[model samples]
Target: MGRILDQPYDVNLQVTAVLSKLSLLPHPHLHEYLLDPYISLAPGCRSLFSVIVRVVGDLMLRIHRIPEFTPKLLLVRKRLLGLEPEGINIDHVTLLEGVIVLEEFCKELAAIAFVKYHAAASSSP
Candidate 1:
């Protein structure tokens, strides 16, 4: 697996693909209900989609105890980094740091999952 900064193009492409797939899944239609198509038609829609996918993916991973979503979280962190401005507002820096913390936490969870999985495999008959 590649680090978020190491393979940004691949990460963004994968995240976009996953989100596109998720959009097809059956669920309450958030875009239709909450977002106006006119507003959503602009570049803001892509930013909104990225945020939604990142958040939903993180919550699902945590709820299900799945480690595979670590990379997705990293991808989101990368996206947030790109959105940061040159002047570096304190609030923005704090938010970016929060995202980094979340990514690191996810990585730790993934490491634990790897260890558990290996232990279980080794102990199995």
Candidate 2:
């Protein structure tokens, strides 16, 4: 004996088919991230984060870009800051959050770069 189909398909397959029919709404932030270098954490904070994220994203994109680094970074953040996930979709939220954190990391690196720049300038005398 076999179960009857709702519309000549398996229930799970039908659900997935229906879900797949739904379209992703276009996100301006994501589009801006792709197109504009100026659209970032802050004006001075832009270049450093942009370069780092672009490099990382480029490397990851070569392997299909699963966005796994976001969660891993969040895990590192949790360990360092004792933060915890707030909701069910924490993984998705971590993507944007991780970018912001990486931006801050880059900003610190930029500070180091600035110090190096000043040191070189002073030493050239």
Pairs that collide in candidate 1 are: none
lDDT digits (tens) for residues 1-125 of candidate 2: 01111122234234333322221123455434433346656555444236556655644543244456556555645643557654434333334344444445445445544654576589896
Question: Candidate 1 lDDT, tens digit per residue, 61-95?
Answer: 44344343455444545555685334532322332
The local distance difference test score of model 2 is 0.43
- Models 1 onward score TM values of 0.32, 0.32
Candidate 2: misplaced stretches above 4 Å?
Answer: 1-91
Please give the CA lDDT of all the candidate structures. Answer: 0.44, 0.43
| Candidate 1 vs. true structure, TM-score | 0.32
